[model samples]
Target chain A: MEIRKKRRICLVVAYDGTNYQGWQIQQNGNTIEAELNRALSALTKEPIEVSGASRTDSGVHARCNYAVFDTAVRMPGDKFSYALNQRLPEDIRVRKSYEVSPDWHPRKCSSKKTYEYRIFNDEFPDPLCRLYTHFTYTKLDTDRMNTAAGYLIGEHDFKSFCSIHTQTETTVRTITDLSVKKEGSLITIRVTGTGFLYNMVRIIAGTLIEVGNGKYPPEHIKEILQHCDRSCAGPTAPARGLTLVEYEFL
Target chain B: MEIRKKRRICLVVAYDGTNYQGWQIQQNGNTIEAELNRALSALTKEPIEVSGASRTDSGVHARCNYAVFDTAVRMPGDKFSYALNQRLPEDIRVRKSYEVSPDWHPRKCSSKKTYEYRIFNDEFPDPLCRLYTHFTYTKLDTDRMNTAAGYLIGEHDFKSFCSIHTQTETTVRTITDLSVKKEGSLITIRVTGTGFLYNMVRIIAGTLIEVGNGKYPPEHIKEILQHCDRSCAGPTAPARGLTLVEYEFL
Candidate 1:
């Protein structure tokens, strides 16, 4: 019998996600996880199953998402980024890869995740930025959005902002920061938090948009949070506008 | 017998250009001009022919391209923007429309044209900007590129940079301004000129990239210009990275 040594490798992944079903494995659709598995398996000749830090929804892009997998391949940690990049598709890239402790789990570790929801607020849609930004002709008032975003900071039960289809033990999450700003015709809503429930960020974006259009006051965020009902909040923003821009493990 | 009054309307058009063949109409492939004609014909119930100020190549984008057409639709010149936008696809838009002199022609009018060549300079390609930016893993020196761009200013015979396939009476043109700037991972080369030969901006970009990469010194641009041979110039940058940003009738 031959004994093989395994080392856990973590990757900083960035993907377009427009063509992907989602980050997780699914039988019916092509996904980011499946692609990574295929590429990793081909590289190491092992049946590698990688675990993702965050399972981003369909059509949602990410600049930096983490994933960890055990491999017996002798390739050094940092060199995996360069080597895996050659094997991966153009839309998916391994930005950085390194070896991690055998027990260090990406999802189990405490981390601060930052996401940006982009809104193209203009008289006409710009084709250049159409893929990443959600087009809204109704001029958004950033001031109102910022005021509403402020209320969501700190620990709060985000049940109202979560999807009804989500299955989680608790709906409570701590949002460290939330902000809204506009440059030119692009409005960016950036939020950083320790964790998030299903569709929490997007639903929050949708509610803020309502506040921006003057349909609701900034203080309405408090009421929505207090209601603890999904129906109270605005509709979930489109998946295309959301991007996982940063994921830092603490 | 009923007769109609025709007005010459000039439009500021913007398009993504990713899906279109080019700005010019052809026997095959969908073009921006063809789309405009189809939309205008549908609106006016006439076979309307639009004259474009610049014939941008395939896969080239534009924020402000000019086109003029004669219409007898009884709609006000400015109002045509709103009406035409409804008929056009999401990738194309009419930014502004106004009445011009009946005899005025887009191509015949002396105009200053400005173009931008975008390069995404980074270790890995950004999926978000993949469609609009040319990805270059090589680190570029913008200062060197700017130095090279300075030599191209003022009136010069650009025969060396002109494509061999292009036909024109004169190869002399005045470059009003040329600049290279870097923001984050994006490098933009902005060039404004009285007129340009076919693939002029793209070739300039390619040559500047060589300057940026230290393949040639900044002064090499002058030598290339003096040579007045297309073979002396660098390769034409990809059309997807180029955009006709501004066109102003002087």
Candidate 2:
């Protein structure tokens, strides 16, 4: 009897995420993981499951999300993108796929993730940008937002910026870069970090928005971090404004 | 007996046309005009009909499409934008509203209209931009497209570029400005003209795309214009790439 050795494959996926209930599989609604599993199963003629690197929130988009699966399929790894894309919906696309060592795992790898939160700061909301941007009629001060973001850099206890529902054991994380840039009527907040707690980026965005709108002083972020309480930070920004821009495995 | 004078109101409308069946009222499917009429009737307690400046095709977006309607409602013209927006779907928005003279008409007046056609030229399609842009895997030559567009910027018989089903009496029109620009992986063709025949802009986009792809020489546009036959030009481009950018009454 000959035994077929199963190989591990890594996939870089991109999705609009408007119709998805997040990256994790849930019983109540559609999700990116569920769709990927269904498409992979249909393509390989087996019940396939994939583990994602990030469990993105509902309505959060992703330009590059990492996922790994083990399969016994005989097809070439590079061809998986084309084959899986044929079975996926228009809103979801497999950007790239490649073979990985059997011992490699997505979640256990050291990676740097970059997120972008977009805000359309204009008197009226742009209908064309409604799907990707969070619209605000109030004017925002970019300088103040940038000042507030500076305090969030380096290793710190991010409990105040994490959602209370998170099950993670530790709230310590390191933010490498955080910037607030304004171009015309659009304000973009780009944050790069080693890892994130649940809803950490969204909470940071919400806190920075408060500073931009003059509700809080830029220096107040230091106190929020010291408190290390979820109630110390601002509310979580809407999920629609957040997007995972890049994921670089170290 | 008190008499309320009926005033003609002009609306500057904007919409994401992905889910609409064009600007004109139709019985087959949902349309921008039908939604407007429905909202207007509900707001004014009477039947309302609007005449659009351009009957844009399905999947054609608009930043500023003009529509005029007579209303007996006592609401101020500027307030209509706010009121109508509340009832309209998120894809459609009333940007502004103002009162026009009773004798003023949108289509009858001399005006300059600008349209933009966007193309995403890359090895792979971007799912985030699929609804708003046309995607082509081929690398396009911008210099050739610009040269072809230069030949289109003058008064001439555009029968070669007009759709065969056009109901217009004449195919002659004056193009004020035509330019093709490439930024990153996206190409934008901007055209401003006195008036456009049915499917004229889309046909022009298609013909220029052929020039850019090396299918036709840049100078071939001159011969196409002189032929004055629809078959002499390239096929009409998809409607998703075209957008009505501006409409300025002279």
Candidate 3:
């Protein structure tokens, strides 16, 4: 007799993280992961628990977020995306789905994630895009931002750049690429990394904005990294301005 | 003895009509206009009212919707937009503001309005854009859709093209321009008119889709218009695909 492999489901999710606490199994208040659990349970008529790749903080966004869950349903993995999307809210979407091994975990997967931070470098605020973008009146030198970003391209001890409450065994991670570009009033900072600590991207963005605004020189980034102290870094940028754009698996 | 001047506040409003009934003040349920009234009353400390250029139906989108409200407040017209956006939801925004003459009404001003309908003509529905786009799998003929759209241009009696429940005094309207373009799996229908009746744009889109799907020839649109019978027209398209792009004040 031929044995059929057990089905493990993988979900690619997109969400407006404005309202939720974060993408985690929160015990208090609302969270994107909790909502997905509710939606998936309703769709599959079973208790569907999921583990997300990143526990993105409140007010953050994800264009191609990932999650993995195990289920014994007879539906094909690809068909689960359509079923889940039909039950999800307008702000959250299950973009893709696939089958995986029962041991597969979104958080444990070997992957490189790309995040983009948007800053509206304008004098007046845009009413339509206030939620998704950060507005600053001071002129930002994109060249300066780019120059500062280049200093942190290699693997480094990012303890000084992460949040104080971050619970991680390793503070070392590889930042493969970073670039800044301006279009109209929008300044987009794209960063690619093997892994990021809690509030790591936001702190980097905040420090870069400081560099762009002349508060800190591009060379100051080198000192901050060498010190490995959180106080040496700039303030954390607001969560709304940061978005997880994409992720590539190895 | 001095004459009191009337203050006409021009508003550029944007909305995601997924939850609300539409841009008009409907008695059935919630609406963008009604929400605006509530927000305006809280801002001005007066029961403010507004008239929209187009009473878009439920689930329609607006990039720069037009509205005019007459108020006696001492607040500057430009500042009203800024203040209102602070109190509005993330999806709705006031893009701009201006003061116009008392006679310059958003609904009555002689100009043109542009509406775009997006059709996701694909085999599978898009998970990322479930709410913002309409999905169809009939394999539309762009040549036929474009040819049928051309017949809609110029002044004509659009009685059969509009919803039967439209209670407008004029069934005759001037459609200044109509164009259809296909990009990959997306088909965009751009329509500009002096004014539109209830469900006019959606009905036109449905009629064009019929022609593109080979249910009717491109020439059938002209015949449908001449019939002046509601039954001769095609089905009404869903409101999700329609977007009020902008209005040009000539």
What is the CAPRI rating of model 1's predicted complex? Answer: medium
lDDT of 3 by residue, A23-68 (tens): 8877787888988999888987779888888889988988888999
TM-score of candidate 2 on Cα atoms, chains taken together: 0.97
Better model by DockQ, 1 or 2? 2
**Candidate 2 docking classification:** medium
Ranking by DockQ: 2, 1, 3
lDDT of 3 at B191: 96
Candidate 1 vs. true structure, TM-score: 0.96
Candidate 3 C-alpha error for residue A121, in Å: 5.2
What are the per-model DockQ values? 0.67, 0.75, 0.23
Off by over 4 Å in 1: none
lDDT of each: 0.93, 0.93, 0.86
lDDT of model 1, residue B26: 88
Pairing residues by index, what is the TM-score of model 3?
Answer: 0.83
With candidate 3 superimposed using the best TM-score fit, by how many Å does residue A67's alpha carbon deviate from the native?
A: 3.3
Displacement of residue B159 (Cα, Å) in model 2 is 0.9
How close to the true structure is residue A186 of candidate 1, measured as C-alpha lDDT? Answer: 97
Give the Å error, residue A178, model 2.
1.1
Off by over 4 Å in 2: none
| Arranged by lDDT, best first | 2, 1, 3
